[model samples]
Target: MNNNSTGGLPVAETCNERITSPTSNLGPQFTLVVLVLLAILMVLLALITVFGNGLVILAFLVNKNLRHRSNYFFLNLAISDFLVGAFCIPLYIPYILTGKWIFGRLLCKLWLVVDYLMCTASAFNIVLISYDRFVSVTKAVTYRIQQGITSNTIARMVSVWVFAFLLYAPAIIIWEHVAGCSIVPDGECYVEFYYTWYFLLCASVFEFFIPCISVAYFNMHIYWDIKKRKRNRLRSTVSISKRVSVPSKGNGQPSRVSFLLKKEIPSLDLETEDGLSTSSRTQTPPQVMDCSHLSTTSGNDRSAALKVKTRSKLHKDKQIAKSLAIIVSVFAICWAPYSLLMILRAACHGECVYEFLYEITFWLLWLNSSVNPFLYPLCHVRFRKAFMKILCPKRLAVLPPSSQSSLREPN
Candidate 1:
């Protein structure tokens, strides 16, 4: 019996070593606590982003007033945020908490694919919004008449999904599993630094660099055009004023002015006097020289000027879309560090400088997921008004009380 027990001791020790080796001495208690706190933060951010973006989408769908080309793009963006929160955040929470992946190879591949695709789609959606804004503001009259939520917008959205799928395909095909200790014992999954790097590079180029450059270019052109238009308007006004103030040739009168101000000058009205009653031909005051008529003309001029100004404002809105593009660019910047770290880690074939940087980058990337909804409200008056209508029904009374209450309810 003693000899049998001695042999069993070696077998038990081997089992223990295999089970504990992966996570042995991984971190101190305080470090674990910090990680837990981070996990909580990620959860809260995900919730807020998901809910806020969902609200934006809901407002668009329910508000007939928001049924337009611009809102269509916003709908796509909101969908992307919803997918990230619903699918990616849940998978990631567990992974981050344990500092390892216990999900199966199939799940890992699937999650990675979805993550990349949704993120790519989201980035491209921003580009589309920027372009749409550019079109609307640059050509307000045409845009107001023609652009709306329609089959064309749906086709564009479909194309965005197709592009995202193509963008994310490589990650699933190329990634290989690495042996590591995960949250679950007896679980095996893959992790590699090269895959991370590849994701970062591709995402940065399409999502960050391209969008940023395009938005900036569009905004600069739009602003320049607006400035030129303002100058032209000023020149036109000066010309009109000069024409109005100039006195014409005289025969006891300014000849050129006589023809221009004929309706106002009493002597000029002599031709029509014989056709009218004596009371209708009463003498006019010099101080009131066609001022009523002039004011009416000026009012028309001002109305035309207002129309031009509204068109210019529409152009400025296109620049706002450019601003959204910049916001997407900022998201790429936030994500870049982690991606670079992952690539470096992979290149080294082990953890090195990337270890600390990776954690920081991870948090930053997570932050990007939470900020865009707030940005939309900040940059867009329409979105802000819509959001307000949805949030505070008393302010926008277009909707009935029941419908407004429903809108305010949590989803």
Candidate 2:
């Protein structure tokens, strides 16, 4: 459609108007002193995460007793933590110093991909652990009697990792890292989420909010189940003791002790002086009785042993559940800030309300990976023993140092 007849042909207006955003330039900004300190701290944390998780994995691998279907989740956790610390956290240092993501488009996408994927893995792993424990505690009686873990434990664990992957893979698959040098001298790469809002919403819900709520609910049920089992055990114990100690009147059954007493002790035949009765005078010499109570006492002993063994197993399972709770508690404390900020960022549609706040949360969330290794040994005696066997074998054979220190001054 050329308008050549008009002496002065009007030119088509080009759509070159720029759209501006207040936060377009807002990136990670930290003071020189703070940034240096933060970088050093992050370095240390990353090192700890790598090394600590390595030790955890090694300990699990080396110790045959630690090899259980549930502990496999910890191994998965170690790998996830290692990835977060090694790949995801190190990328932040450059961002903080330059106030821009300078790691290039490929790396920028990689960072976001690894960040969400592994973090989701970690979160959902905890959920898996909690649900597993809930199952264990709730089905304590059947579980102990069966003497085997349920068949679905492995399936549940696999499902957790799969869900984590599927939830965050879209973020990477739909990733459009727009790169431009004119945006800044150093160059800029952005994870554009405007077109992926629905994906982001679903990922956020499935990967975080729902999982957290479910974990908390499952842990509560586990706690109640443990308490209920404890009460039932106490009731059964009291009833057993009463049955053994109290005699049943007008019934055919006597008390356990009385039955044994009556069986073991025979009547003493006495001689009557000046009586001519042959039955009383030279009665059968007080015959030695065979141990008549042996069978009853042995049977009682076997039942007691069975009870003790069952109690020990339950106690061990409870301890394991408690140790897992400790891990989850620590994880919750460290991850809450990150998850909350992530929700805020998601709600804002990638328009974060504050600068540098998410970075702080990022640091907090990374702290969990570093802390998990230490929490295991501290909270669980089995892990403590395994660690000691791995690191301080000589010291483990020796008795632990007394809590009452002789070096302390008399108060």
Candidate 3:
């Protein structure tokens, strides 16, 4: 066994001894199988996450259409994913295989910090994207003017990095080395459970709870607004029908339906109209129709359609947010059991009957990190398109002018 001192912990041992050490108590066959499986999974996950996130970044950078303020959040998210895969996975896979943290004290702490920070950043980015979408859809005019692509993009990028660093700062301050031999005799590093919990709680709040609430609330508001708008539209249509059905001024000529049709219906101004405006406007022109009147009616119809589309888009966003929330929540839920079991084991200095369950939970948590990239593509159309473009570039190539002009433009 090898040994070195850093923050009061022992290190320096042969890799094979670390793997087969009696301290680990893992049989040769079992240990070999676990290591093999972990290696395979890590390799696969690293490739997927790296390539998936890389495609997202490439899409944003290369496509002028995608280089908008709203997409900045996604760019940050992609960066977070890439960092996690590059920095976290390589270190973690070795540790898992060796069953010990052979890396030095500094590296261990740094890895822990990076892992937490990147994961938090990723979650926060998703929340920001949801919020941006909400604003763009609900208050589109304001979004276009006040929160344009450049300013909002820079602000969000800065905020994500700043928040990530702040979130991880506590870990650096609180982390301390604890004495333990890893499953691999050669692997040894500080394990700071106290700081781990702190990090987890902070991450859970910023990453999971806050985003979940913000997305859900906005989506609910959008839904309610849509329903209200639909009702108002139906009422307007009924009123217009009633007006059209009314007989012409006692002329007994079938009430000249064309004349009524030519008359412009009052515009439905949801933003400006109050109860008083409705009452006051009752005395306005009852028959005169002008182009401006037609334009207003057309504008209201467009606005109503836009609201419906916004509501639909928000509903999809809500589902994606909910799915991500569930992913994080399930991670916490699944991991909590084992963490508690380990804590009990440490405190009581006794064996726990739920070792099997603990192992299952730990593996499940690992699976969470592995599966997120795949889930993202399924939940997001942009990500899906990016993935397809990456996988089959020729298929996504721009068409000739004749074909291109015919394709519906992106809003």
Candidate 4:
């Protein structure tokens, strides 16, 4: 019995060494608490990611109002995030907790493939959404009419997935074979190319740099275009008011221009009359231009109504673009650290960068997936209503038509 007990001491000491090695930087109690907290946080994040994205998918399917061309990109994003929650994050939890790839080589390969494909798809979907918003806003007249046509939108969404797959799947699938030996060790699972500086730089460029640049450009233009449109609207309102306002021969009050009644200005909105009073307040007694005839003119009412409808459609498009901009901004924040660290990891082969920083950045990337569901509802009223109705149908009160903002594109 003594001999046996003495013999087991070495085995016990080896086990202790193995366990302590990974946590040498922190106290044993502190490490335990950190690991436990991480495990809990990760579990919560995974559940939220799945639930939130699932809600988005359900809302999109049920709410016909959300089936517009721009929103299809959102649906694509939700699907990718849903897959991340369902497969990628959950699969990674054990690896994170144990600090080993205990799930075996086959599962590791499968996890890596799905993880890269879905995440890259998610990034590409964001870029697509940004580009779509740009086109819709800058070319509102043409793209507005094409919103109902599904073919082009479908093709774009499909291409995002296909491109994402081509970018990462082929390399992940064949890297071991190409290298003629497995670079990943027996108990570890990571992309073998992380050690290759050139590939990392190229991947970072395609995945992070280009997308960031494109989003920034699109968003900047969208902002400028929106501002320009508003400025033009104000100027048109001012010019039309000036042209129509003439001094009455008797009371000195402004009288309507005869030509305005003789011909229809299709761009003229009834709202222009409201602006006339506001603009006149600074210079003279508030003179309300008589726009009653403008609404009653032959075919002018139809034209003005059409103009109002188009303007409203553009307004809704602006709102949607703003929401997507928030999404893109969030993505940049979450991804920037990880992307920079990846380049560092590649340049130094993990010598300069701390492992904890890499792990934090990894979690931050996943955090974006968790955050998007909340963001959609917060930024977009339509999505909020849909989510409320779905989650608490009985509790949801019917909204008046005036209160309900329809996100549908104009027919």
RMSD of 1: 13.3
Off by over 4 Å in 2: 1-29, 140-157, 175-186, 194-199, 247-314, 349-352, 397-411
The per-model lDDT (C-alpha) reads 0.57, 0.58, 0.54, 0.69
How would you order the candidates by TM-score, starting with the best?
Answer: 4, 2, 1, 3
Clashes per candidate (backbone, < 3 Å) = 5, 0, 5, 0
| Candidate 2 lowest-lDDT run of ten | 1-10
- Per-model TM-score, in order, reads 0.68, 0.70, 0.66, 0.78
Q: Stretches of candidate 4 above 4 Å error?
A: 1-30, 247-257, 260-264, 267-321, 397-411
The TM-score between candidate 4 and the true structure equals 0.78
**Tens digit of lDDT per residue, candidate 4, span 1-411?**
012211111233222222212212332334777888978988899999999999999999999877878778889999999999999999888777776667899998889899988888888888897888788667654676687789999999999999899887888888656555554556677765655667777887888889988888888888887777667665654554554444333444323553443232433432221212212222222255344343224334444443464466547657856776786689899999999997876576566788778878988988888887777544666677778789877656566555454532232
Q: For model 1, what is the C-alpha lDDT against the true structure?
A: 0.57
| Pairs of residues clashing in candidate 3 | 2-12, 2-13, 18-184, 18-185, 248-255
Positional deviation of residue 44's Cα in model 2 after best superposition, in angstroms: 1.3
Clashes of 4: 0
TM-score of candidate 1 on Cα atoms, chains taken together: 0.68
**lDDT top scorer:** 4
Q: Candidate 1, 309: how far from true, in Å? A: 3.6
Report the number of backbone clashes for model 2: 0
Tell me each candidate's RMSD, in Å, in order: 13.3, 14.6, 7.9, 10.1
Per TM-score, the best of the predicted structures is: 4
TM-score of 2: 0.70
Per-residue CA lDDT of model 3 for 1-411, tens digit only, reads 222221122343422232222124332335667768858977887777787677777877776666666666767878887887778878876655554577776687788788767766766776676677666545655666665547657877889878877875564535332233332223453334321343445445665567657766755665565566557656765655555454444443323443443342435433222112222242346555443333334444544553454345445534644654554454455345545554454333224334445455545544444455555544555555555566776765764667534432243
Q: After superposing candidate 3, which stretches have Cα over 4 Å from the reference? A: 1-31, 177-186, 194-203, 244-266, 269-389, 397-409
Q: Candidate 1, residues 1-411: lDDT per residue as tens digits?
A: 112211111233232232221222333423767877867887887898788888888888777766666777778878887788878887877665564567776787688788777777877776777677666545544555566448888888888888888865564544322222222234433322222354545556765568667766666666665566556545544544554565444334444543344333222111111122112353456565543234335534543553454344535544565675566567558756765665565444333563446656756765665676666644666666677877886776876667555444110
Which residues of candidate 1, in runs, are more than 4 Å off?
1-32, 173-203, 247-329, 335-352, 394-411
